[model samples]
Target chain A: MPQTIQQKFVHQVIGHSATNNRLASKNKIGSGSAPVNIALSKYWGKRDATLNLPTNGSLSISLPGLGTKTQIERLESQNQQTDLVSLNGQRLDQDNAFAKRVSQFLNYFRETPQTFFKVDTENSVPTAAGLASSASGYAALVLALNDLFAWNLDNKSLSLLARLGSGSASRSLFNGFALWHQGQQADGLDSYAEAIDTTWPEFCVGLLEIDVKQKPVSSTQGMQNTVETCALYQAWPQQANQDMQTILQAIKDHDFATLGKTAEHNALTMHATMIATWPPIVYWQPESVEAMHKIWRLREQGVAVYFTMDAGPNLKLLFLETEKPAILQAFKQIKILEPFKS
Target chain B: MPQTIQQKFVHQVIGHSATNNRLASKNKIGSGSAPVNIALSKYWGKRDATLNLPTNGSLSISLPGLGTKTQIERLESQNQQTDLVSLNGQRLDQDNAFAKRVSQFLNYFRETPQTFFKVDTENSVPTAAGLASSASGYAALVLALNDLFAWNLDNKSLSLLARLGSGSASRSLFNGFALWHQGQQADGLDSYAEAIDTTWPEFCVGLLEIDVKQKPVSSTQGMQNTVETCALYQAWPQQANQDMQTILQAIKDHDFATLGKTAEHNALTMHATMIATWPPIVYWQPESVEAMHKIWRLREQGVAVYFTMDAGPNLKLLFLETEKPAILQAFKQIKILEPFKS
Candidate 1:
């Protein structure tokens, strides 16, 4: 009997001893929680699509309060042929897109043909609104799985498993800053995120929600299109890698100006590559542009506020605690989160 | 006296014989008119700023009705020590920014230190509103200069002179389709635009005016900033050159699909480079983003409409006559013009 490529990769990360422990689990209920992360240096353009290996390294900051909570338990009856999944408080049908994806991920962990899991998940943030629920969701799920099997794998091992679910999920395993290393390998065993271990107590993130609806294009598909069709994208991986290093240095030095400027530039460059794509993926709506202009105006008026955008139209602002009053006055609806503070 | 680089280039284009004619002329009034041209493949970076040599070739379509009309004559008295410039019906002060730029350009053709010109220019389109009035203004001014001196120089020679004023002005020397060659010479003698000679009568341009006020940053400065600070801009010149050939081929083949797609992608890529620049150059307003979404929506509904943007917020839409009804229905304020038609 030969293990699948994914199984081989998983086994390599957790070792053959842990692989054996998976079959020893039966009906133990395990639960875990994780936080969403906003990328300061974005991850885009995968080197290996199947393995979700990024072409360049990325850096992020996690919001501790806004994230996902999940619980998992092995099904007791052999008659249950499929995994039962629920979101928030409602049970999701197996045919649901979310359930289907979760089931596919669970396939990597099934001990036997008759083994099934009942998975319950809840998101503190809006799902699929580019708050990166999948990052925290998959991270929490991997932790739950780790607890269920009693593998006692370290955070790095759990991050590797989380990355197999979503590329950004690797960064969500940590509470503060995390750096996802873009490993130079074919098998992608080295590609995982670890905590940066630096915390800026004054650092703040302001979420300006332009739209909560599902994005018109998924980041996965948008990145693929950009990598395939955007000629300007040829320079992105190099710039992104450089930005990652700059951001890491900024975090270590506690240089807010360098960090804010580099993060904003990195996000804009990522969006630029998407804009240069053939079908032209423009995530900016009228409100998005308006928010950008507002940010620019505030900057012109001597405010130190800067912003970074994801694959969706929402903007996540970066500013120190000193500018909180100005940012609050300017954006009345902004949801402010202090990442480093309790 | 040693000639300036500009004077030497001008002499090389018009010949030493025309250089003498420029000096011999005194009081003859010369008038010329030219249409503003919209670039299908944008000219963004410069290899030589002194000679206005571009980094890549470009393609454009001339708007026959929207342009500049200019009249020029040498000052008869030595008391008139400065070039007197005016726009529309108002006489501009010698210290005005527009007058200063024009006088600076006219210095290349000055017969002597005391030589001066009275220039009156009128633009049918909005000045500095991203309508490219500068392209047409420079082209008409060059033509008026040629007429004043009775140089009898061809359009190619005139285009060389106009390019010294503004890079896009080289294409404005011809109606219909034109291609500006990105010459590979130290002196920039080979960099001139010529008529493409293939016209699609059904080709239509719809102007979506987002703003008519003065642009915050000039295209000249914006191009320089992008070239200098944008890391992603390394791939731009090659993509722009390739797009030039593709657009030229599309014009010859009368393939509207290929032409529109390439032109829009080129424009977006150009903007992408600017966006990736440090201190990011964003030309889109809220209305501009709204218009872009509208254009994308129209395309999703099977309309063949596409748009191109310059360094300002306005959009120049491209579509065939068959889609005119659909475009008109979509954008009520849009002003449509046919390049090949009167």
Candidate 2:
């Protein structure tokens, strides 16, 4: 029988020995958690949609307190004919989009036709609000699978598996800074994220939530639309890759100005490509623009703060801890997070 | 003495004969008026700053009854060492930016260093509000100059002179539809706008004034910055040329869908290039974005309306006469005008 591309990829990662070792005991429950990450250098276009390979390298910082926790257990009962999935404390129907996606990803790991699993996941952050819950959700799920089967995969292998679920998930596997390589291989084995080992305690992030509602268009679809229609997007991959290098160096040097400026520019450039697309994808709301102007005004006033936006209207502000008082005064409701601190 | 590039270009347009014929008599007060035009296909970059030549062709529709009127008389009085200028019934100081730009433009027309002019201009529309007042301002000044000198020059020569004042002014010389050709010659003699000749009587324009305040960065500086710093701008020239072609064809075919869609896309693409630049130029105010969302929502609801913006936050909405009532219902503050009707 011909193996599906995903199955082939899973086999390549696990190898024959690990594939044969799907755990002798089905009684164990494995639990894992991961933090949501905001990309400083964004991963925009995809080279391979099926394998979730990005066209450009991306760097990100994980928000320590906000993410997802997942617990996975084998369903050995004879009555369990399909995978059971629950989000938060509520069980999700098989046809629910979230549940269906989880089930589809699980298809790669099934030991046999009758083998089933029950997955329970909880998000500390709002789902599909451009906070990248999927990044942490898939990363946590991959870690749980590693623990449940006693596969004991290293971070690199685990990131590879998580990337199959969501492209940004590769970066979510590591705390603090992570760099996802835009690998050259068509097989996509080389394209995975690794920890950027440097930590600056003064680096601070402020979340300004304009909207927590589900995004109108998913990042997966938005990326495809932008790639297909935006003329200006032809310049994005080169710019994005260069930005990744700049940001990577900035992190090492602990240059907040370079990092903040590059991050803001990268985010705006990504949004520019989206706005240029046909049936233009303007993710910014009125408040988003207002917030941008306010940030610019603050910077003009000598406050060293900058912001980056994902595929939605919310903004993630980057600044040093020294400017926290000014930022707090300006944004009354902002939720500040320190990635370096526990 | 070697002539400046502006003098050479102006001399070429007016010719040696008109240069000698700066009117046998200076007593005549020449008066002229022009309508402000909004570009359907934008002219964003400069090939020649001295002669104000554009890098790409543009198309525009003039809004009649909403522009500038001017009267000019050569300052024969010895007391007037500089050109005397007044705008909207108020005399401007010699050092005022507006008066300085006007006096500087008048420099090309001086018969001698001592020959000065008294220029009085009135704008029914808000000045420097992204309503292209400079377009009408230059066109009116050139028309007044033509009349004052009894140049009897055809519309084409007048357009060439108007272009020397401001790039979009070339299109402002004509009513209804105008196409400003992006010429090939280095001397800039071929770079002039002409009437498109075809008119759709149902063609309507709606003005949504989000802000009438002066733009922070002028279009001239904005274009220069984008050209120098924006990577995405590399793709703009080709796309703009293509969009100009699409819009020109749509105008001829009276294809509202093609025209509206192309114009809106063209404007957004131009703005996208600006946003991609370093120290990004974002002209959209919070209210501007709010207006855009309202327009998009109206379009989604089967209202065939599209909007275009220039270097400021104001929006020029495009639609047909048939959709005017619906548009009026949706946008209570919209100032609607019929181009073909006037």
Question: Looking at model 2, how many pairs of residues clash?
Answer: 0
Cα lDDT of all candidates, in order?
0.91, 0.90
Interface root mean square deviation per prediction: 0.6, 0.5
lDDT tens string, model 2, B169-218? 99998899999999999989999999999878999999887864324688
Question: Which pairs of residues collide in model 1?
Answer: none
Positional deviation of A53 in candidate 1, in angstroms?
A: 0.7
lDDT of 2 at A103: 95
Could you tell me the lDDT of residue B104 within candidate 2? 92
Model 1 misplaced regions, further than 4 Å: A127-129, A212-215, B127-129, B212-215
TM-score of chain A of 1: 0.97
| Residue A170 miss distance in model 1 (angstroms) | 0.3
lDDT of 1 by residue, B1-342 (tens): 328898888878889788788767653998889989999999999999999999999999999889999999988897998999999979999899999999999989888878899999999996534597899999999999998998989988999999999999999988899999999999898999999988789999998888643246789999999999999899999999999999999999999999999999999999999999989899888889889988888998999999999988999999999999999999988889998898
